[model samples]
Target: MESVVGNGCFRLVREMANIQGRDVFVADLYVTPTWLDPGNTDPLLHFPKDADQKDALIIPLWIPGHFLLSVMRPLQKEIFFLDSLYFRRADGFSSQAYRELLRGLAQQIVAGAWTEKTALDLKDVPKQTHGNDCGVFMIMYAWYFAMDACFDFGVDDMCLLRRWWCIVLLENFGLEGYGRKFAHFTDEGKATLRDNVPPVFRITRKRKLESPMVSEDLIQYPSLQPV
Candidate 1:
């Protein structure tokens, strides 16, 4: 579970080029632990000095068994806290403490001080119906926001979303014969997935899959292909 959350964050950063004309800066997950450490006053040290200049920053928060998303829009002087579970209290830290920490981080990044308060607010983002969907929600939150699109997805859409996410990752990493794996999807379903795809991804050009070597491997995971 922890690995899934970490991979989600990694994929977001690795596939960031899929979002056209966006310069979202994502901090390393390792810095999260340092931020959570109460004794660490210079938690931002792990972040690049110029991170504050980016249009948006995505930070993944993990507390033992849960994950959450924190976005800082420095230009707008606002920090948006998104939790799929909507828990009043997260696993390892009090909501107030976390909120204060976020606010302080935003202030330092944007205003370079703790005296100025930015518009820190918890957004009513989409929620997950199942307990295990938090990691998916975190990745989706980063993906949608980075693309400058609203997240209209919910728990029910996760299965399909997960498939699309896999396709995107595979495509980004230049895995061969990716198109062959989803040959059964109707043009409409394919179009829907394409429409939701970030503009930077060039999936319109069809690449012929000439080899059948990986066909069996793909066949075993038909559920991961779009229906």
Candidate 2:
């Protein structure tokens, strides 16, 4: 942090602090299809720099009107699937290209999470009866699979689940002061380069976290040279 005294990165320090021991790469919703797009310039999915210790990789996929969840445990050579409507995916959606996309995702994950690949084992999960609850099932699957939690939810829990989600969303977004910006730098009275703090303060940020962050930690984020 001293190297970046007045530059930005204080929040990176805090978020890094929060995730120090936790490890899971939760891909953005609906990103599974991009793996098969050879013409797509997007880079292959990567594990976090500190992904030496990972629990699982969670991905939510939307095929046609339905959404399902896929969790990859690369170390175990296992890819688990949870679909609300367990029937084979509808016509065009079940094309060979789509199957290849999922396989590509599994291959990338296994290669990144581990060193080699074998015949990955596909595991089935409890299915939802309602057609519209695929979104909800997907979310829960990600939650459970990430934590290695059990499949305790079923159709009887649907009503309570929907209402619970409603309350959670409202409480998350409807309340005032719901989202607070990171204020460590501001608290340090060093919000900008113009408000520079002493080197000790910046260096102390790393020291307090008890984690040595080398230049590689911020490879994508070039550190600003101290003026």
Candidate 3:
């Protein structure tokens, strides 16, 4: 069988099939750049300073929604959704537990009940790269994916914040397209990224919800600050 690699939900699918990269030429669909000619130089995908090339793919899938982005807002205008704090312990963090904390804190931040320090802590993890860069991961990815799944999802205020903050974080990291900019890429750079997608990549169409539903916990209050 040809080895096929998958991102997000693709991991489960690939695992079931026992595909390996060498056999199938597996690659992540979202992060690959199509325009890099391999002959020409493009700084966009350059590895960070002092970073090992082998260690580059160590991306975390945990994004703390607006909990980190809210505090990092003023400094950078674009935040990549891939930015995340990585814990490489043999016995490591629980994804469920961390996601619960992020959700709870995001709710509090929206409610205007979160303290300034709490916001800082969420945004300012010590081992972060990019100097004070607050990495966003899965939680943020889920929110963004929801917006892509529906227009109504994009119009919601919480969704707007998520998008805006993501943009800011990316810009801060000296990359283009975080939120709105990122969406535009879906059209502009779509050809490039799509073309670059490994041939073995499988496209999965998501079922759209019939009704525009905002998470009950995402309800907006009068006191919520303009994002």
Quantify how close model 3 is to the true structure by its C-alpha RMSD in Å: 25.6
Mind giving the per-residue lDDT tens digits that candidate 1 earns over 57-158?
Answer: 777776667777777777766566767766443432224556678787787787753332211233445776575877788777777767767658888898
lDDT of each residue in 64-133, candidate 3, tens digit only? 2311211101111211222233333222232433333334433432333332222122333222333322
lDDT of each: 0.62, 0.49, 0.30
What ranking of all candidate models by lDDT puts the best one first?
1, 2, 3
Off by over 4 Å in 2: 1-22, 33-52, 87-98, 112-124, 179-227
Which candidate, 2 or 3, has the higher TM-score? 2
How much does each candidate deviate from the true structure in C-alpha RMSD? 15.0, 18.5, 25.6
Q: What TM-score, over all chains together, does every model reach?
A: 0.62, 0.54, 0.16
As for TM-score, the candidate ahead, 1 or 3, is: 1
Considering only N, C-alpha and C atoms within 3 Å, which residue pairs clash in candidate 1?
none
